[model samples]
Target: MAFLDIDALVGLFPGQGGYRKGALASFWDEGDPVLRGVLAEIDEVALRVLGTDIGSQIFGPAAAIPEGPELFQLAVYTVSVATYELLRVREVEFGLLVGHSMGEFAALVAGGALTVAQGAEMLCHRIAATAGTSGGMLSLSCDVRRVEQILDLAAEPHVVVAVVNGRSQVVVSGPEQGLARIGAVADALGLPAVRLPAPAPFHNDLMSGVRTEVVKRLGRVRCAPTRTPVYSPILGRCYRGDDDLVDILGMHLVTPVRFDTTITRLHEAGARVFMEVGAGRTLTGLVKAAHPQVVILPALTEPAAVDTEDTDEPVDVPSPQPSTTDEEVMAQLRAIYAAALDYPEDVLTADAHLEAELGVDSVKRIQLLGRVGRHFGLEPSAVNGIADHETLGDIAGQVIASLEASGGR
Candidate 1:
């Protein structure tokens, strides 16, 4: 049976300053029932946490800037949850989800692992627990290996790589002195690095104390199984039904985020379309750099009015069938894999072993299968045996089998 065009939706939650100026005003003026409902929920939580209406703080005349670390983190969380609700009301469906740093709580809520109320409470507690910790984060335009090398050379005990965002982008977190040392090293190498506007050194050993407290609190809080699969880059895998949510979330505080690997895994799992669900284009930009061929849509862009009515719904885009002949299918598969892997078409052939001959890594193999799945309109289950295919010819055979199973001509 032919399935409805299934596009993988990835929800992105921004870390800081996600809601730009006038964000509240836009939500109020639009008067979307979904937005209103989300606002009310957030306001209720804000009142309990901040002892004031967050709506007024954000939308009132002479709006107060989110100054304190705790308040700023709360603002980011609240706005992200509201944005997620707005998307849900519009019938946006997510196949897989991920978040950056503080955005993980938002991802859990969106994925149904936690309710909005639970998420708000957890986030507020996290902020409160980690508030006085010293140190900060710095973004570096260098690979993880190089960053580690620099850290090793510097011998700075406090600083550590906090995130592996992409092939060339990483974030390091530590005290001011450690950061200055790292910056000097980057300068010597002529690499660009900038200090992130974070109030504390998050996703590092510095937050171990906070992680323990949060985990204990999470144990007392009830959590439901996830509806949408939420991948934790920190844990380097998707949250399974049997896994301990509290332990996972607790460890997430001290683990470095392997975002690059997360994207690869999602693509391998047949996710082709990624959408940034929250207030900025940060995650969108990272995804683009990681996978240029996949479709990316941003739910919000700064300085532009959010018009929920005009957003295009994801529909299955048709793929061309070159021919049904075995030889033709093999040729087409080679071409697609070559293009996706940035290798010349001649480098791949029916006899070439995907790994030994073509240098196809595990992540690249997953990407290859996803592309094939989309091209021939195969069901996700149809591609489940992709790991068994060792050579180009072997993959071609599986594709032919899937085509026949799907009643494709």
Candidate 2:
């Protein structure tokens, strides 16, 4: 099982429904004492940076935390580090380490390139350096060439394709007006588009100022050669021990994420079991889409039964629940979305436009769909038409239809 570090930011919150809150809790409950000590150290750093207990915010009752690019990035970094520690305590091993977007920092820590505290500190400085930049990103359900053609047609050169996630998914980032132009072009091209909830256009030339500052700050942090191989999609290859971590990571801010190519390379390198180490199964789904034959698992949400035979310790994770009625499914989904998006349950009615009215972005949309797929025991591809649904009611109806078709209810 070649463990793949799923980016924490892929999922909005760990404990929220549609997410495996129990799985996250079990890690802390069943982990070694050293795991707890590591978490305590991380908590102290988090308190200093955030002025609040990040552990409490994530592990406590489901609630909305401060929403912004910097804070969101920090929360992702915290959960990722904790998840990595839990995996280490569990004695899970990986042949290679890869992270999506900000997940690279967690990969570095897990691969022995940086201490948890050093990684956390670097993330804090990263947030500070990139703060107040003006721009946004949009996810287009089209290939890179199509997006580039659309941009050319619209005469919008500012918007650059920030991430090539898959054959059908590409993320573009630039000035707000440029993003708007891309949206219009996508609409005119009849391509599905969703605006990401980003405060600035990352992985694009818009972040040049951020890059310079981050590079200078990153040089001050001590980094060692990675213990495990770390594959960098931003650099389009594996990171040699002698590579300049500071320059590569700094340039990562303005370079496009070639995840599609990265996954292919991993497969070529003989990685069969891809395990996502963080909050959600976003990367899992993407990996499945790109390489369907590979075994994919979510480290934060895997059932204990699957691993009991490998370990001497007993595992006590919950089993899958019995199928529920359509109404029950709808209600559960509503609650999940509400908790995940931090919106009132009442607002997630049949008529509410998920994107327009509720401001749900592509990342959150993927999280919601991933949760819905798990809750109902559906395949990852089962939630394909999620974007076509305009309202919660529309989504509920789709889920019901899928359930009925699958004989799940």
Candidate 3:
């Protein structure tokens, strides 16, 4: 079926492990112009960096996708960008976009902060930056809370949660000893821990040196203001105009991504339609777990591979926050926004649009939020970290968090 959705659509870009050969078989067979153009732009940059175009590895009649980490990453980036372009050509009106781990590079391109060629260039630099680093990552089939227990059991200080994909998906990064300790603990706890064939520990303290190298190398490729409104789980906020793009992108090398929170935030922001515009269905599956009520689409019409797990237990889709405090928070937020906008509190419903229906612009939002911040004594960072202006409920959750956090202070 065609990916047709009128609701607020969210486009997801999955990272590293989301690649497979022949991902774009149908697109190539159909002679898609948009896909061709995107690949051409990336090949020009890839040829200069790797001495051969990435297109030669992913496309054409006789393509041999290399087993090396660098090549797999290149293919993932290329396929993701190309897939995004194909969707854009089809006029898929994505209301919000997000990237998982390294997939943020492609999201930046879609968000207009980076060009397609620049995304590919940054990926190549990323591959080069961590080539010499050591250690590995292990995926644990349990929630982050359970993973924390494993970490405590392991007593490996360097071990850290590198990626929280969903309720039951977590990947930790650390040195070999740290990883071994965690694995042993996980085995003891009866939780499955699969070690990745990662030559370098990603998004952990071990990447501290590599982070600086990334910033220096990508000094020429800073992300100029984003236009498409992208939320970064790694950064824990949307890309602000004043954000140090090069630095944030650099820091991501060592910063873990709270992707489960990203999905929850997007769902709060009035997004009920989602699609994974990449090479694998991993992001789609994670989205399904986070917001089971929302509609989700696969990576493409024909994907080379689909992500799977070997667990015996069935996946449990989590329900929304059932606490009475959450209901109170939403009601309190409606009153706050209603009073600020001079609208009747009854009309300031959860689904009320902040921009289209309420006529609140970004500038007006900043000014209004500044007043709310002073009135509630909310933290400046909390008021400023608003990711999107889609609905009152979207900003409500963040504001409520700020209120709760600053209540004691």
Candidate 4:
């Protein structure tokens, strides 16, 4: 299958603003750009909602911001909305929908518990409200029972279970001191633990301030019935109504996420494909570790070979693999673009106008620009003016013009 404009999905991850172009190119080359496109799209949303560099702070692109106590909730909403959009587009059949941390919101959105625009607005509200607390979260690979015992023994302040990602992986959160205590405990226990690059401690008591605000926001929005099966990390049951969505979403902001259990149960129920819809392969990695027998796919990931900081890499270019012949090159380019668009190839021609003939709307044009930029090594910025190209032949002619400008083939 030809690559879809996957790089466009970077709008999903918040911390990845610094590497957008490089990230998109690498994503396209990975042969699975759907996830990339979803992530890019979500990142765009994050920038629009939080302004400035909120996404960077959340994803460790920079230092964490003090969002007061509601910071956790804000983080959750951002991640959730991204996932929601991915699931909304495919609506693929699955035995269960599982989310890690704030990803539960995505599950709810995918299962039809919430509307896309509503989810986006809610995420905005969450981030705006939670910009108060300064904290972080940590993930540990250890025996859950032992970890719980250690938590009890240490009795640290500002510490709580954030997520149970697997039998061996548990995410903990709270204040810095409490997290430090947990880390010390984990070290003594011989459990491998790493502090997550999050802005605030999520799924912990420190986020109590987020609860009232989240509830108030929930009151302002009406959830719809779910069209797909969604397993709640809080209730540990399948939910299908607005009330359930509200309850789960509200409680999830404070409750520990049981993603491990949710995934296990889903697999047991016969779910084979686990698709990480928006941003990063964090969930996919966890699922693979948790269930080695299960097949998991991440929508986006950094290709190991690509250097994210290399600006010299062709911008907005397509895959570098050359076509067999000149005619084949143009035909293949058209095929790649058609497939990238998920549009019919029969509707396209070398001289066909992208806008007039292919009906390349603005959104699609932007998406195409992302692909074309990758293919040609051209970095895509907001193009200021319409190019003079009125046909595919015109586009090809421009490519030749650019190559000639650089004294090329």
Q: What TM-scores do the predictions have? A: 0.69, 0.71, 0.71, 0.55
Alpha-carbon lDDT, every model: 0.69, 0.66, 0.71, 0.52
Q: Write the per-residue lDDT of candidate 3 for residues 160-195, one digit (tens) a residue.
A: 999887777788999988887887776566555555
Model 4: how far residue 324 lies from native, Å: 48
What tens-digit string does per-residue lDDT give for candidate 4 at 183-283?
77765654445555465676777777786777776565677777656656567766755464544566666777776776666555555566654433445
Tell me how candidate 2 scores on lDDT: 0.66
The candidate that wins on lDDT is 3
Q: Model 2 — which ten-residue stretch has the worst lDDT?
A: 304-313
lDDT of 1 by residue, 363-386 (tens): 344445656777887765566444
Cα lDDT for residue 240, model 1?
A: 76
> Per-residue lDDT tens digits of candidate 2, residues 1-409?
2433432112111111112222355555565465566667767876776565455644445524434556656666666667777777777777677878778888888888989888777777777787778888888877888988988887877888888878877899999898877777666655667666676788998798898998887675668888777777777766777777778788888888888887777766566677766655556566777777767655755441111100112212222345667678677877777766655688678786564345453545655665666667775445654554657888888887877787777
What TM-score would you give candidate 2 relative to the actual structure? 0.71
How many clashing residue pairs, candidate 1?
A: 0
Model 2 segments beyond 4 Å from truth? 1-23, 26-35, 49-53, 61-63, 302-409
Instruction: Go through the candidates in order and give the clash count of each.
Output: 0, 2, 0, 44
